[model samples]
Target: MTSKKSITRRLTLLFVTASSVVLLALGFVIASSVGKHFEEQDMEVLTGKMALAGHTLEQLKSQNDLERITHLLDNSLVGHHGLEVLILRPNHEVIFATPNANFPIELVSVSAAQNSRRPITWTQGEQTFRGIAAELPTGISERSRVIVAVALDIAHHQAFMRSFLQTLWIFVAGAAALTGFLGWAAARRGLAPLRALREQAQVVTAQQLSHRLSVESAPVELAELAHSLNEMLARLEEAFHRLSDFSSDIAHELRTPVSNLMTQTQVALSRQRSADDYRSILESNSEEFEHMARMISDMLLLAKAENGLVVPTREAVDLAAEVLALFDYYDAVTEEKRLNLALEGNAEVSADRLMLRRALGNLLSNAVRHSAANTTVYVRISASLDAVSICMENTGDGIAQEYLERVFDRFFRVDPSRQRSSEGTGLGLAITKSIVLAHGGTISVESIDGTTTFTIILPRAP
Candidate 1:
């Protein structure tokens, strides 16, 4: 299993990593731009010095005087501090060289025909220099030529750049640290709503399910989550109440029969009785046992159905046949009440034959029991291309509107009184609904105008 991690840490890491990448890229671009600007400035300075040397050489051609050129070079070197000048003849002879100047021969060897001007960098001892070399015409003879070399000290520039880069990196590191700290703080602050939600959720218990998340107060990003959590709480509360009621109803239903069996047995045992009296008492106890058994059996069946253990056999079942069979079974009860049993419409559905019969029997039994005397208990089945609907409608003092929705709930009764009568174990409709649901169908009940209809709709067999 994957381990859980804190959302705050994840967000902090993301923010810090992104900021670091951006800062690093920006730092690189700025460093490169500054370096290029300094290099260009150095090249311009070197080019100007080369131009000055060429002008001084041009003035010497009119005199054809080497001494005059030497004097001018010395003066130029003295006037411009940190400047080096070297003058070479066409025969590779060094005509003039400034004090402490050691210009590279390679620079002097460069022919004007090959390249008019060339800039180069050279290091002497501990200092670095940038210089340019140009071959100039003497105007005295066709073979007479002068190579002028000029260089500027760039050691200070190098030192400044090194210091600038060190400082830039230091500032970049500081900025990254500051940004990461700020990002972590912002991430934590931004997720305060989620923290509140967690605290609220942690406090929730079964008894506190009625409490709901405050959607309106939540951030927009978390509103949907809050609403979903609230909805889940509502469902949990509803299920909890249903389970509580089911427990109470089960205990109430079982207690009566058990208490009666215990009382009757104790009374019968209290005094010696005739065999017939004892047999009668035993029969009464048997009846109570039978009721308890039926209730337990119904509860078991409902549990199986809910747990998806009721796998029904697929078979074509005739609805009318099932209705007629139930009518015959409940014939005595119906006749005593002077009720009429009517079967209308016809449809065949794919379902377990025994389950179908049981479902219809329950519906008919309920109809006959609740229905008024001389009223008709109508069983109707309608078929469509995809589904078949079975409606068991009865004319009687109909169920109240409030109880209609929960009529099929196990051990539920329209009369809240827990009196043990010939009515039922209060699981008849619940069993009917469970059976119908197992067959990929739905069962619903509605009452209106002294008429209640329980409708079962099942998918038609292909």
Candidate 2:
């Protein structure tokens, strides 16, 4: 593939091309005007000479005056260096001619045929001339009319024009070169902001994603680009931090159950145990294995949800009915804690039934585990023109304000000092948020006055 030219080179080339064209046009106009002016000056001189020659021809009374007239015309042109004259009778016989003047014969033929005084140009050997010819009436009886042709030598005009053209061409060439250099410099200076932006972007890596381009310092044309790049960098930095935290959380979560298994196995191997003792140890290890399995499964589900791989099968689902089903599943736990389950309102939504149930189940289980005994757990569902709202409120010692925003982060616990429990994995709220998001819904939590409420908004069935 052929390499493309840089912007600076392209701009410089275009500027030079345009400037050269304008300069050439101006030069042509100047040269043509000057040449025409020289012609006009020569024609004025030629016209005056023709009038003089005509006046001299009119003085003729007979053939006798012709000889004196010839002498008079010759003396009249004595001081003129490049002027020539010719006079002829009606019979085409030359009455007088300048010595070695060598005027073109075609000039006489055209002038006589047209009988015009308009100036014409012709070349004789190395000399160019502008001249005019006309028929004049004379006082002689038999020779009543004569041809008076006057010519001017224009060798000086030609020499000056040649010199002017050479100088014009030289100036145009120099100007083009100077303009090209200036254009390249201007292009380079104008693109300095883009170069700076590129340098800033180049310094960004996984470890240094916090670098941002300066939008305020950028040129107006590149300001939007710089701002967008800054936004992208911010997102990358955030994602990197989240990934780091996720990896650390996974390690922390797995270490507990693994340590328990190892400790139990070591204790069992330290002695020869009876069948009942071995059976008890194996059962306890099985519970730990089950907890690990559940944690791993939840992590995988969250991953799939984050990457948009969790596509839901849509159907019409009743939010109230799903809440009732969850209450039934947790009936034993509620009775054991002396807690009451209550629901209000009812709305239908288009969602994946299983995913929606799981999301609600996670919220319900969390509410049941955290609620105070003899308190009420309420589920409310409402519908609008476009959406359905499901809010789960439970009475408890409530989450603190500071930890509200991070409730949906994986493996995050409000009380970090608490030991890991088999009652639940910390991934419930995170997985619930992901599932709600997959169904084109939003979830948020608020805690106040010893009550914690988790509200979910899903699009309503059409």
Runs in model 2 deviating more than 4 A are 46-80, 84-124, 130-151, 266-283, 304-316, 335-339, 417-419, 438-440, 459-462
Best-matching candidate per TM-score: 1
Cα-based RMSD of candidate 2: 4.2
Worst 10 residues of 1 by lDDT: 107-116
lDDT of 2 by residue, 38-133 (tens): 988888888888888878877788778976677989888998888988887766678888885666666676786697777878887888887888
User: Model 1, 21-133: lDDT tens per residue?
Assistant: 89889989988898778778877877776777777766664544755787776765566777777778767688887776767777557633355565678887887877777
lDDT of each: 0.83, 0.88
Candidate number achieving the greatest lDDT relative to the actual structure: 2
Per-residue lDDT value at 125 in model 2? 87
How far residue 119's Cα lies from its native spot in candidate 1, in Å, is 4.8
